[model samples]
Each structure stands twice: as structure tokens, then as C-alpha cells.
Target: MHWTIPLTEPSLGAEEVDAVVRVLQRGWLTTGPVTEEFETAFARKMRVKHAIAVSNCTAALHLAHLLCGVSAGDEVICPDLSFVASAAAGRYNGATIRLAGVVSQDDLTISPKAIESLLTHRTKAIVVMHYAGFPCRMEEILAIARRNGLRVIEDCAHAPFAWTRIGHQAEFAGAIGDVGCFSFFGNKNMTTGEGGMLTTNDDDMARRARLLRSHGMTVPSFDRHKGHASGYDVVEVGYNYRLDEIRSAIGLCQLAKIDQLNEGRRQVSAWYREALQGLEEIQVPFLDRPLEQSSCHLMPVLVHGSYPEIKQQLANSGVQVSQHYQPISSFTAFGSGAAHSPFGPWCLLSLPLSPQMSREQVRYVTDCLREVLAQKQLV
Candidate 1:
């Protein structure tokens, strides 16, 4: 196909539209039954006991920090390779942010040992990300967190069902952590336009997350919506992080097809790996095995040398390729002079992998990539 293919696109179907229509017809468009249904289905799909839907991944992270009771000067260790929202969550709750180096170039997930080395009396939590659907070393990281009495907050933005195993047992990534956060943004494994979900087994933590997602409203939102009861009150100040019914309706529908969409992404990733197998300078991405069955959110790759030129060439060839991310430290908010790895963020590229894409299409894109890499002397 000659048309533009986005790096990540929603796997929306007719079911999503029908569900949203039902919700819109109901007239109560705020957080309601649809949101609750999305939460329940998301929790069940993740095989966890609780899931709280919110406005976005940022809200989920902020609520996790609040539930952990992280405050000013308290440190939370997070990977520098991920989106800024991961660390900003700590700052949102008035906590000190501590950055940790990535484990390897392969997956770029945070190393448990790196996190352990940074622990101190002020350390409050470990915000580990499942980079690009590749599950981190959860067992090692959780062991360190448990040993240090530090809370583990999972960032599932890139990983959906990515989890762990223990000698004939199964362990979902977010379930093992103290609190887990997930994004349903358009570019994620699955999307709700803009939404997030939080999961935890602890009842107290679940309650606190609920309060924080709302405006710290003391009354159940359902009751306030009914207006049959007395007026509501805000017991604690909170952000407006609730996921409205319209978005929740979309999310609930999306959750039902999560496995199908995930499988498509996985197949696309496998095809990319196989097609680019022998290219000397082109390295397609892979998740660290023995742990995660990644949802394959993106197919970011390294083209040995001519990375920038390859992107330009691919664009000229009518292919849409993009860098996975820019180093957060390179941004103005984090300051300009801080040193970043030469290949850390700028060196990677993402290929399209949606259910809407076909095997032939994936091959076409890869062929274009191979051509560009070769022309640029990268492969």
C-alpha cells in the first residue's frame, strides 16, 4: 500500500461505535456504569482483582503516588528511557524523582540492580515500565523492592498482558507490583482515545486511588449522579481524572477485543523479525524472553549508522516511520545541558503494526526500510 501507515493506530471496530451509541443515548455521560464495566473487564483481562479507569496514564501514575503516600523529598526510582509521565507522577504527589539508568539496549527496561543501587531511607517506590510491551525483570525488581520496604508501581503503558512466571506458575506484571498503571492512549497496545486504568490488590490502596481519581469526593459518584441523596463533598483535594462514560463505553468495547488486537501486533512483530533477519546493520526489536509475552506496541529498530538519513529516505519512499521517543532530559523542562546516550532515543525507529495492516503491507514497509538503510550505508 502506498498510503501512509501510522506507527500505532487504534483497532476500533463496529462494536465500539455501537457501544458508544448506547452510552450516548443514555444521557448520563459522566463516569457511570460504562466506566465501571471497563474497569471490571480490564481487571479480568489482566487477571487482576482490581482496576480503576481514569482520564489517562498520567492520572493513574499520580494516583499511585498518592496512594503510596509519597510526599515532598521522598524519592521514587524510575527509568529515564520512558515517557516523562513515569517520573512526573512522583513529582505530582510532591515526591523527589530519582532517575535510574536502563538495563540494556535490547529492551531498555529498568534493571532491578540499578534500582537497588539507588535505594535510600527516603526511597518510597520503584516505578518500573514494561518498555515496548517487554516485561522487565519483575522477580528481581520485586525482590529488591520487598527487601527495601519500597513500594512497586508498575508502568504498563507499553505492555498490556506482559507478565512473569515462577516455575510452572504465571504472574502478570502489574499484579505483582504494589500498584500498577496502564495507558489507553491512541498509541498504546489498546486505546480509548485518551484513558488510563489502575490496578491493585490492596483494598485500602484501591479506595485511595478511587478518591484521588475523582475530586476526592467523599460520596460515591453514582449516588451524586442519581441526585436522590444529599449533596456531595470533597473530603480531599484531587485532580479531575475521571474517565467519562463516552470514553468508558469505547474502552469497554476495546477491552473485549484486547487479545485479538494483541495477537495481531505479535504476529506483525514476528514477521518483521523474520523479514529483517539477515540485514547486517538493521536490528529489529525483541522483548526479553522467559518473562513477557509482549503486546508488541511498536517495532522500534536500530539502523547501525545512518539513522536520521534512513528516516528521511523512508519518508521519501512513501513510508511513515518515526522515532520511538526523544530523551526526556533533552527536553527544556529537564534542562538542556544534561548528557544523554548518543543512541538512547534518537537512534530507534518504529514501524506500523495494527490489526488493520496486512502481512504484505508489513513486508512492503520493511522492504522500503531495507532499501533506505542500504542506500544510507546503514545496512
Candidate 2:
């Protein structure tokens, strides 16, 4: 079921291959110097004090929940429009989830007002996801957290270099919250095959996350193998969520080119915006926001009529499309019937997007969309 253009593609090249080969040649396959280097580079890029590389984004989110004191009986408030992992991480710690609606159809981020309304004495933390690499209304969200004495965990899976205005300063997505969790999956702005990074400014939380990422050992196996530590002790209960050297090396290569790659994405998004403009049948979210502030991980459009039919038509035309997410409440696992976002997920359409995309490709997609809509009107 391969379309002419896939939903997304990672920009991997000879540099990544060389990086992986170098790691294999070094023979220290587990998390070691390369992982440390990746973490340092990522932290420096995001302007964070500490970055703990993990097995995946879920591990980073779980660690963030633990570090923020989200435990059983406590509630974690997050957007209903986000991927399930946004809430699942809190559920991992036995915390209940409170779903908050989005701001509007034009800005599908979590509503700070909705978050404020859902607060309870049992609320422990607020999880905000920057949808499609666009910064959430972080200034307001952070103010809500500060007012409620709740920790803020940013789900930066969709936003790597994206930033928000905080007062006169521009703070990077992962650096604004109490703890930021990032994904480096194959489709993300950057790729490490499967890996994640947890960032924090708090020294104590950073130490705890690093310790807990690798089974709470007093000393990591890498250190012991290098004669830096004679022995080790397990001080706290933790999981085996360490990123290996191979992925770290690849991550380094990806990190090096992320700025340029994201710029390409921004350009592609702009092309889509221009191509789709004046098509009253479709609406693009976040149009009011400047493109430079977003990593533009996705090009989601709100289809006005018969979304399923249009999606199928696009498929027939050799175009690929996707949905950012379905309401978390729609899943049987989360059927406890929480308030859902009113952004009409059923009509949300994600057109193919990648830094590799060309203006011609975008125009083709838009043309297909217009033709499909015209055909539907006659039916």
C-alpha cells in the first residue's frame, strides 16, 4: 500500500551511515561516549542544562512524570487531541488522566482555559504537547502551572527546534517546561531510528532521570567498563531505558543537520499554505502564527466535506494522507468518557509532508484535493 509520496520520510544519508559504521568499529556498542556526546549536543542545541538520552520518547515521558511527582491518585491534565503517549506516560505512573479541549479549530493546541477548568486538588502535573511542531500557548500554560503549583511536562515529540515567546525572550519548546520529553523516531524532525531525550533545568531532577533511565545504578555499566567505577549499587527502582552508541552516533549526524532540514520543512509548509490558499472548502490551522517559529513537522488541513471520501480519492490519485490523531476518548482503553477536544478530529487531514518535498509535489496534492472537492459537489 505504498503511495507515490509517503506521509513522511527521514532525511538519512552517507553521514548517518558513516556515523553508524564508526560506532560499530569502536566496539563499545552500549550507551557510552557517543551517547554522552549526543546528549550534550542536544542539550546545547535546546539550551537546557541536562539532556538524558533514553530508549524512546515514552521512556522520556515516563521519566518526566516520575520526576514531577505524578503518582497514583494524582491526575495529569493533557490535550485530548494529542497522541496517546501524552496521557499514557502519566498512566504508567498510575495517575489518572484529565482530557482538556483545544483552543479552536484554527489553533488546535490545548486550551489553557480548559486546563484551568479541569484542575482539582488531586492534579499533579500538566502535560502540554506542541502539536505539529507548532509551539503551544506556552506563556499562558506556564502561568497556569505556576498559579496551581503543578509541574509542566512538555511533550516535544512534534517540536524539536520550535520555540515560544516568553516575555521578551524566545524560549525553545523543550526548555520552557519543568521537564521536556523529545522523540527521535524515524518520522520526527530528527531521526535516531528509535530514541528519546529528557531535558530539565533542575539539577536534582536531571540526576534522578539519568539514574532512573538505566536501572538506578550508582554507576552506569559504561563507567564500570571504563574503570571509572569499581562496582555499582541499585539505589532506586528503575527501568532499562538506555539509548545505545549506534543510535547516538546517528543522532549526532542528524542533530548536525537539523536546522537546515527544519528550514526545508518550513519552506515546504509555506508552499502548501500558498497552494491551498483561497480554497474555502479547506482550512489550515496555525496560519496566523509565523512559520519561522515552527519546525513544521506536519501539514494538517481541515477538510470541510466528506473527509473519508476525499481521503480515499487522494489515495486513488497516488497521494498519501493521515490524521494527526483521533480523540483519546474514542479508544476503548480510555472509554471512561472524558471531555474531548472539539477540533473535529474526523475532518482533520494530514497531507504528505517532508523536507524532501518539492513545490511541484505540493501543487499536485492541492490540485488533487480541489478536483476531489469539485467532483464531490456534482455528486
Candidate 3:
């Protein structure tokens, strides 16, 4: 009998359980020392200055927008083929969002040309998502934003340490833009069940984010007790987006193994590339390029003609296949009345590739997909 495989699973281990138990023993299970340690380690690992932990990536992006001076009637340019939180970041700030071009069927990353067309005088910020852990064309996107005098916020919900290569070199994904946001949900490479991080080099943005993430309070609970005072004050309107110690505790241990985990995912991705290459029914573009310096946060494949059936076929074979997203603008909260356009609502499927999965298991999952495609004469 064949076994089942998950699309994306967290590479967790005993460290997570041990950390959780330690945090529980500490008794002050709210945001505290462990959260601070995780933030610092995250900042160092991502090569950023400041890291603000939050409830999730949505809150991180939302807080980033709020601190970036986004307001009602202001416009933010975003990629159409992104996770909903990317655009929702602007919506939470009461900003009008305009989603434009993403690399068509080739990893679905946003294109600079598509975004440049949407910019106007009201365009305050440009949120670029590293779709499926693949970095967008940052140099071109940054050039466009600079020409328009717009703030750049990287939606790194997909790509954490994934690097973007331009010309002969590469740089970490989140480190390129003004601010970067990351998700640590259970499905991510490293997870704390549900947590997020906001990273920035700007001191003021960091201060505001620190405050905004915790009720926009007059003080961080960490520093509150040092003054021997229990009463606190609110300086600005903020949300309860703080990451708790319990989650951070788990994150700290997971962070240590992130690179190894990413390497494992990369190996799985390479196996899929080798197995799925030369197939007419699908294409894996990112694979043809360099994988040595990349982090495989997701393994989204471009489905070719009449390929939707492959997803069902693979599922029936006990291989749990799924799409990375349905695009941000496809949802009613951000889309047209009801019938959202395919430009932002169409194809892109994530293949099973997790660090915890063995090489043999990875090959089997791709074998199932390969078998289905062959049966359907898709190749």
C-alpha cells in the first residue's frame, strides 16, 4: 500500500517540545525574554537590524503599514498573485490597494512593469510579495518605487531567508526592502504554530512597530515591571498583535534548525525538478536557475493545458497536492463584486516538499504525480 504525503509540513522536533515545557515552567507565558531572544536571533539570521515578533504575518504587515503612514484614500501597489495578507495589510490601514502584474505562470512573482502602471500621486507604498518563497524582480521593483518616491515593504510570508539573484550575485530576500514581514505558521518551514515577524533597518519604524504590536501601549510589558509600576498607558491606537512567549520559545529552537531544514527542502525540490523536467504538461522554471543559495519555502509548479484534473488525480493517489494560494484580489474582501478576474485568481500549485520528509518519500510523491500525468497523457 502507498503512504500519504503533506504538501508543506513544518520541520519540527524534540527541541520544540522541550522549549514549550521550559516556557510553561517560567510561568510568565506572555511576550518576554524568549520572545526578545527570538527577535534578536531572527534579526541576525535575516541580516536585518530590528525584528518585531507578532501574532502572525498579517499583523506584522498590518503594523508595518500602520507605521509607514498609510491612511484612508492612500494607495498601495501590490502583486495580484500574493497571499491575501499582502493586500490585507493595506486594507487594514484603510488604504486603497491596486494589484497589478505578477510573472505570468512562472512562479507568479510581481513584475515591476505591472506595478509601475498602477502608481499615482496617491501611491504611498509598494508591497512586493516573494511568491512561493521565490523572490520577485527586486532591482526593477525598487527602481520603480524610487522613481515614484514610494516606501517598499517586502511580503516575505513565503520567502524567509530565500535570496533574490540579480546579475551575477544574490541578496537575502527580506533584507533588500525598507521593511520585511515573515510568517511562522504551522505550515511554514519553521513554525510556532501561528506567529510572525516584522524586520526593518529604520529605527523609527522599529519603535513604532514595537509599540503598535502590543496595544500601542505606553510601554512594553517587558520594561513595564522594571519601573515597579503596573499601570500603563496607550499612546496610539494599536492592535493586540504581540507574539507570546510560548510561541517564541518554540520559535527559538526551530530557528536554530531553519537552515538545515531549508537545505532538506531544497533537496526535495531538486528531486522533483529532475523527475518533472521535460514534461510538457508542467514547467518548473526556478529549478533551471541556481538552487544552491535559495531557500525552498514553497514548491509551486505551473500547470499546463487542462491540468486541473492532475490535482484531483494526485489526491486520489493519496498524495495531498494543493495550490499555494487563490491570489489576493480573488477574495471578495479585496476583489470585484463576485466574479474575480483570472489575472489574479488562477493557476499555481504547491507540491509536497518538506524537510522532515525523506528523500525516498519525496521521490515517491513525485512518482505519484508523474504517474498521473502520464496516465492523462499530459506529458
Alpha carbon lDDT of each predicted model:
0.79, 0.91, 0.80
| Candidate 3 ranges with C-alpha deviation above 4 Å | 1-3, 165-170, 226-230, 305-308, 337-347
Residues 119-156, model 2: lDDT tens digits:
99999999999999999999999899999899999999
Candidate with top TM-score is: 2
Off by over 4 Å in 1: 1-3, 166-168, 287-292, 335-339, 342-346
Q: What is the TM-score of each candidate against the true structure?
A: 0.93, 0.97, 0.92
Candidate maximizing lDDT: 2
Residue-level error in angstroms, candidate 3, position 365: 2.4
- Per-structure clash totals for the candidates: 0, 0, 0
Write the number of the candidate with greater lDDT, choosing between 2 and 3.
2
Model 1 C-alpha lDDT versus the unseen true structure: 0.79
- What does candidate 1's lDDT look like per residue over 1-379, in tens digits? 4647666577788988898899888888888888888888888877788899899999899899888878898999988777989988898777877777667666577877778788899999999988777777888887888888988899989887876674466777688788889999987777888998999999988887888788888776677768866777788888789999999988877777777888887788877787888887766545335322776777777766545677777777777777655655566665364655547333677777776687888898988977766666633
Q: Stretches of candidate 2 above 4 Å error? A: 336-341, 344-346
Indicate whether candidate 1 or candidate 2 has the larger TM-score: 2
Cα lDDT for residue 237, candidate 1: 84
